[model samples]
Target: MITPAGTTAVGVDVGTTGVKAVLLDEAGRVVADAAEEYPARYVEPDGAEQDPEDWWAATARCVNAVLARARVRPADVCGVGISSQAPSVVVVDRAGSPVRPALLWLDRRGRRACEDRADVTGRVLATTGNRLDAYFAAPKLAWLLAAEPAVGQTGAGVLMANGYVVSRLTGVRSCDTGHAGLTLLADLDTGAWSEQLVDLWGIPRGWLPQVEQPTTVVGRVTAEAARATGLLSGTPVVAGLVDGAAASLEAGLVQHGDVCEMTGQSTVVNAAFEASRLRRDELGTMSVLPYPVPGHHLVYGSMVSTGGILRWFRDEFGDRERQLAGLDGDVFAALDELAGTAPLGSRGLVLLPYFLGERSPVWDPAARGALVGLSMASRRADVVRAILEGTAYGLAHNLEELGRLGLAPRVLRSVGGGARGRTWNQIKADVTGLPVETPEDARGAPVGAALVAAAGVGLIDDLAATVRTRQGVVRRVLPDADRHAAYQRYYSVYRELYPALRRTYDALATLRAELAP
Candidate 1:
């Protein structure tokens, strides 16, 4: 394939809810974008899995749609990049077929496996810069080896979701440093897989893929991939970072003291700092990993179910909103309007948005969602408002933790689906008592992936320079003093809910497991 002088780059983001592909021009403007949804199977209360093949199919569909929509020829695509949900375990055979369903980052079936190795907890944390938890891929891989030994025996290689797509695209099995850091198998200091950690978990070192920099050109789109996805054969494929890091890049968080709040299926609050400022105590609760930009690291806290909680409410309780949506109206907009009708603090109602347990600040896998202070006067809209406020409180909780580490944001750059809601953005601003900035382009991760692809192909000289030139804040929401004062009262109560119910949460988890078939 001959590349044109005016060629573009394609960035594909495989998220928890769907796959989004964006095509960007030389000037970093989005020429076209498309998205396709897929299902995450919840086999059990604490288990979440997805078919690797479904992700590949969604990627192909999204890429083809974006290319066709842009009216660009295959030869006009200069490079391709991918960003995806990380720490997801996909074990593949020698022929690249998945031996079993990929365990999602939210899957907690491996909690026992993670806890059984408590003896090496400090060593693992020191080596990987991540604590021992079911969230990391190593624990899930260990669980699979124990529960499904046959699959492990047949597994010739292990890859993250983005690596799986990269292998299908170019027949190269490789992972980026940002994604590798999440696996708990990589040495944070050396940026490579650790032999001691691998041996400690009893994982064959051969099962892991090679680690590469986020912008490195790992391979080219092969003939088969071209036919399936409509991308040009031999187009350069860059190793991409995880979705949160990519979104952070797009939010221009390379500079110190700049924080990004990515509100998607999950809300990730990340602050960047020079590598010299890394501390061990903070790593016990949050993740401290390498950023795509060299010499900088990202310290982030993730809430596993922020936006997913709203989706749960919309599906289970918002029947009228769904019917309105069927009539060519926006359901989320309607829900937002309903939430707007409620008073601040939802008239004494408070909700815990831990629908899928939680990740940051509170790493308890056994935690569950709860709605407190409900009364007969409470209406559905109040519940809706409580959900939104609850999520904001969670964001504020993460921000407080970051503040303790002296990495708090003076101004939070908000990006992702939740940023689109004016009411919700204002709620976040009020709850966090910080100014919230939203970029002109809400397609956060995909835009960042495209920027990385452009840099990888030599179209852009520097990632930070390109971001500064191309990205701009279109809107800013400042904190309302009155509203912030009111939210602070509820926020105090919100902070107490989890600690008050810790023992109850554990007991309920035990009772539920005992009653399960």
Candidate 2:
């Protein structure tokens, strides 16, 4: 049912490849939606960047599109919540205009700086639940400081996508705990930027944006921004989360022992807890975020690759199927048919699924993927099935390690592109020996952003209640006893393959670089 006017909220997700906006009423149903794609520039061989202007342009397009589609007046949007890809480093000048291209999260060009400053990073992650790798923002920021002397003169401070847009909207520069965690500047326990880290990285503390809770009202939209994006000038903009945390909220995994696993080009498993502090051990990773309420914390354990591996197969081996799927038919149906032809365990073939270096539990980037037990008799179907099972095994391994730390959960909620495929969902259930549930919308980040905005505007008391209203959207996939048993044998082998192939991966890395020229 269409909602009565003037009680709706809008969620904006500024992701890596595109920007997505969703409009929802007080009842949590989506009333309008729009998406706008942008480009990520590979400025160097291993570097990725995007113009901060592109993000704002995309945001304007999405906001305008959503309001036009919903036929709602500017006054109807009670509040707007923003979520964006984490770890993006944007340097803005005193005038709040970007001084350089934004350094994206996927850019690996800063690896040397990240490694050379490992000690600084280690101390930071000890409090933030992330390490000094190319994934976080500080190293990328440091790289910019060294590479662009112009940055030192023109740059005023480092702000992420959320803060960048917030500045554009309100003329007040700020970010929430979620994006702060990605910066490796915030102490996870205190949820404040650390002076010790600032000294360690030798960056000016004055440049950092003030941190706020996710649902706290940052500021009202500026008249100029309102004119540019069609939002009411006085509309309230709330502090929002990183995309993964927003997805967890949309999946309703906001309580202790609740887990949300997102499978996109990457897979990230986030677990929430009410603890004031988490142990600083290295078994897995943790990040502090607003606990669906004030004074709460959430931690995340992530894997670098999940569906990305499967996507490689679909593109390489499913050319004919893709052409057929172009006609609006199910492309995955063809893939599923191929997987079905192969037996459980892929006839002893196993895949490691570490195309990108792994995160959490293992915490080793030197780790690489492998396919074992290949033979002349092995067919394409067998290889395809092995990759699918390999990804499931990776998740199972991550969950198992999470269990060792006393972080096990009863239910696993799935959301993201990979969760929609029945065969993939079934493989996850069978491999993990756990029931998997998916939300009706399955568009987790945007939904979560809307809920956060509603909570901020007093439409919902808390995140848990907001999530409860949408529980009916979830459908559970139960474990299959026989399939679980077969996967058990395969998983044992899968776990062993990584350690066994570590030496091979190191040599292969060397070989790959040597052959590059």
Candidate 3:
């Protein structure tokens, strides 16, 4: 197929920490990108919220900056796509203004609501291919209905993050199929809203948005959105996938047995498979949802604290590194250099990175972080290296569980901020004894959105073929035989720490709750 001339697409990703916008040309190369940050309010112990207006403002600023920086004309941008964090609750009134701050996917305020539906757990699992947990949308909506009864009575609809953004841009209410799966309210078999589940939750059918495929052009930019984002009015807008699925698509994990590992605030590993291959009962804590590609599904697992643990260390213990960063030096680079000096196994020290409990494989909410084999001879670098190695161990554990379910991935394509660090990717490869591949553009979710936009506007014919041709791997990390052998011994011991200390974690949690003032 001959390539279209003078074509470009804009992709905006609304993430937990910030919003990122990327401009991609016909060949899927990033022309320019910009990011804007916003605060996530954590007023209550288990609450996390963000202003929907803030996301809209950031999206505008990011998109404008990308176009200006790249010197691209608005007319050249033929299409726009949006991807965002999923399962969030963004209540909008009739005029499309937010009724309340969005409840983030990380918020746990809906735990009670999730627990109230325990009787139908089996049916929910079978119908939705997901567990009934606070992480899903139904529980969050239930919490909103009880906490803010006025909004429920009068609101126009409750949408996910990307859905809300799309509404603001085009005056349309719709969500992609991939994100609808996160609601625990969509029927996997029929690929639509489940009236039974929605009625059971007591939420009005009007509250849910219309569901559409990922590449569908749901609407065009309104004059207001055009003025705010510096894009031409009437530009096509595609209904994009959830953030994780977009990353998977951009990483070229479109076929069965293809896998992608996203390492950012958390570690999410997704493997693609045919829809018929989904075995609901065997997927313990792993979510099986529809992939962007038709007739395929994504089986995935997550660890709540992967790069989050490393960030905690950098904030609390890396004072010297922070000072260096203030002087135009990179703190992570300094830490990486220091960790490289440490020997294998960090001199027998092992660190468990469960600072926020865990989600997959171990699925223990009471699990806590631990530092074992600490000695006077151990230097700060040993602790740093141990943190990196510990996260790799956790990844290996989840991979083992996926293997048991007959979804083992042959090679893991790595993406996210961690993929930029060669040392970390190499360490993960060594610990898991699997080859790791990094794409030329590690920030792939937004790029994937742009690709979806291209396909939506008929600029690209075949999605999978376009991805394979355009997105190339920049680097490959292969596990060293000797290092892999050594890691096996340490990983064996690492696997035992959680089981051995489960009782202790429970005791500490109980005491803390009992002693609350």
RMSD of 1: 1.7
Residue 77 CA displacement from its true place in model 1, Å = 1.3
- The 10-residue segment with the lowest total lDDT in model 1: 1-10
List where candidate 1 sits over 4 angstroms from the true fold.
1-6, 327-329
User: What TM-score against the true fold does each predicted structure earn?
Assistant: 0.97, 0.88, 0.93
User: How big is the positional error of residue 353 in model 3, measured in Å on the Cα after superposition?
Assistant: 2.5
Better of 2 and 3 by TM-score: 3
Using TM-score, give the best candidate's number: 1
Which 10 consecutive positions of candidate 3 have the poorest summed lDDT?
1-10
Better of 1 and 3 by lDDT: 1
Stronger candidate by lDDT (2 vs 3): 3
Candidate 1, lDDT over the whole model: 0.87
Name the TM-score of candidate 1.
Answer: 0.97
Residue range 1-517, candidate 1, lDDT tens digits: 2233336989989888889999999888889998877889885558899999999999999999999999999988888889998778799999999999999999988889887899988888888889999899888888889999898779999999999999999999999998889988889878999988898887888888889988888999999999999988888999988999888887888777789899878999988877887876565577877888777888899999988888788878999998877866667878888899999999899998888889998998889899999999999999999999999999998988888888757888898778888889899999999999988877879888888888888878788888777666468999999999999999999999999999999998898788876
lDDT of 1 at 140: 87
Residue-by-residue lDDT tens digits, candidate 2, 433-513: 899999876776777787888778776666677786687767899989999998998889887877788788778766755
In model 1, the clashing pairs are none
TM-score between candidate 2 and the true structure: 0.88
lDDT of each: 0.87, 0.77, 0.84
Order candidates by lDDT, high to low: 1, 3, 2
